[model samples]
Target: MKTMPVLNTIKKRLSAFALGVVDLVVRFKRTTEKMFLPWDKWVKPEGSIAREKLFSRFPRYLKEPAGSVRCGEGWYPLVWDLCTAIEAMEHLGMPRIGHFKAEERLGGLFVRVESGSFIVKELARDAEHRAAAICEECGEPGSLQLGHGFAKTLCQLHAAQRKPHKVKTVPIPENLATQRPKLLFLDTEFTDFDYPQLISIALVAESGESYYAELENGWSREGCSAFVVEKVLPQLTGGEFFQESGYAARRLREWLAGFGVPIRVVTDAPGYDWVLMLDLLHHELPPNLYPTPLNFYSESLPELRPLLKQAHDDACRDLSPHHALQDAEALREAWEVMKEHLHPAILRQYLKL
Candidate 1:
């Protein structure tokens, strides 16, 4: 009877310890789910039964229940197939996907996974390629359609609803061309907007001398954006224009040397085009080339934007736009048309004319 109280006290303590352990495990599981599952934060499609089934079947891969699927209903099959493939490989030492998000970008499916294996990546790539040909709105055969400032993969019926915007063209002002500093209008096509790697570059001088080259190597086709693959790659003329990167750089240097004067570089996208050009030159700018590049879309030249667009439209009427040489030539034409309309103060501020 004396030892019965001690036994009862020990049993109560043991029960409390067990309960505490269970509570800690529950908290840890919740924390892990919150940390690894990000689908709840993504933009999901409405009334997606496939998404619900995906989450239900792959609780280990997709832990979030609240968020909708980030893509259209047409892509549900692709996502489902991709997830099924990934699940099949989970036991084979592949890294579990901590976060997953799928969306349409540049008329193609772009799937982002925080962690995965080589096979997983390949599966994702295959799905994206398939998505490029399938309509995002409905499960129908489709092609990449280019609009005014957007691109989409749509079937004939859906594409009919989204017509390309027409831009008005204006006549070039021939008499008021500013002639000084020898401007070289530059343009470059690259792999993608997020991380651009130069595929081709072109420079069109004010005097009508032009240089254009396509890189023979140093860029992977897999890294190109859907927009680039559809719009830019088809325009490449791979005869004499294609050269190795080092040879292209050397040839570009030689071309700059031929000018025999300090050339001012101008581009609409100085951040990308100018940076890539500098990298191609090995960061050692030629003495004849100015250190700073002039941006045609600079904030100081707000009045020139409309005219520049019109001139580009006019120039591109006969020539294609995505081709680097043609784009550079279009930039030169825009500059020719814009200079005549710019106030003297603005011209002096940029060109010192």
Candidate 2:
């Protein structure tokens, strides 16, 4: 007893319609719930600050019908991080904060939690250190700004009245008046698992000049991690600029010569990138070019880690990460933050700028 073909099709369409109606109802309910929540806007985007000032009165943690928590005393940028930490504490178990204040002298955020778990206490301490690195005003990347012989974490813009900030000035070297040690940050996406067969390459200079090209027959590696699939794949949409490996190699060599002398290349993954680049370039890099990792100068510069982290935090990223140029720009940004601390002559010599 087979049903008519038209009757079966009608039944399938009805089922689809029923499911669509149910889905709409579910979505509408969720949208209504979010609309009523007072603090929904804060955490949606990571860096955007939620609140500027804390409530002066009681019920800091608003109850049902208007669920929200207030920070005791943190301003822009750092306030975002502070609220994030408090939200984490709420999930771990709401540890009621009895007193909260900014400790400028200590470079910390002090939150006295009266109840709940020990993790709240730890988070309180964590927030304090983070606050020290972030400016309480603008969210821009800044260090602990000190003025009038007093220390406060703030960006240069907000801390305008602070004690004279030192900036190292270096003159162009006499012998190589026109040439500077331009940073060429190189990063690659490759084909091989154990041995890197080159797939794509990006070279970013300090001036924001970038040369990016992918091999026409670049072998697409299988079994890549989820990160590569989700993040890297979408960005690598092919372009007409992409060329055969051999032609691209010679063009790259000619471009290198255009810079005149001494190209300092930085690679985070030194071993893999060096091997892949050498293979792509046919033999080895030119005599004037030297590639080293961020760790190369780490021993002499013990302060680089914190400086780098702070620089990274403060930067408003202009380019997408994983692409070679953006990663290089990041490295340059970190070094720029630390330049004033370096002797002017040494800085010029080191960066060739």
> Best candidate, TM-score-wise?
1
Tell me, what's the RMSD of every candidate? 18.0, 23.9
Candidate 2 residue-wise lDDT, 1-353, digit = tens: 45788888976676556445434543454455457744444223345433432221112533322334332133334433444445444544565554444333433345444445444445445556666666654555557643222344567764552222222223434444456556776677754343234667877776777777777653433423345557665667477657898888887777766777767666556556655666567655565554333232444445555765666556426557765545556666666676756688866554434
Please report how far candidate 1 places residue 289 from its true position, in Å. 1.0
Q: Please write out the lDDT profile of model 1 over residues 69-104, one tens digit for every residue.
A: 556667886776666556545544466666766777
Please report how far candidate 2 places residue 74 from its true position, in Å. Answer: 65
Q: What TM-score number comes out for model 1?
A: 0.49
Q: Clashing pairs in model 1?
A: 44-68, 44-69
What is the alpha-carbon lDDT of model 2 when measured against the actual structure? Answer: 0.53
Task: Candidate 2: count the clashes.
Answer: 3
Q: Candidate 2 regions off by >4 Å?
A: 1-180, 191-195, 291-297, 316-318, 345-353
For residue 216, model 1's alpha carbon misses the true position, in angstroms, by: 0.9
- Distance from true location, Cα of 49 in model 1, Å: 53
The CA root-mean-square deviation of candidate 2, after full C-alpha superposition on the true structure, stands at: 23.9
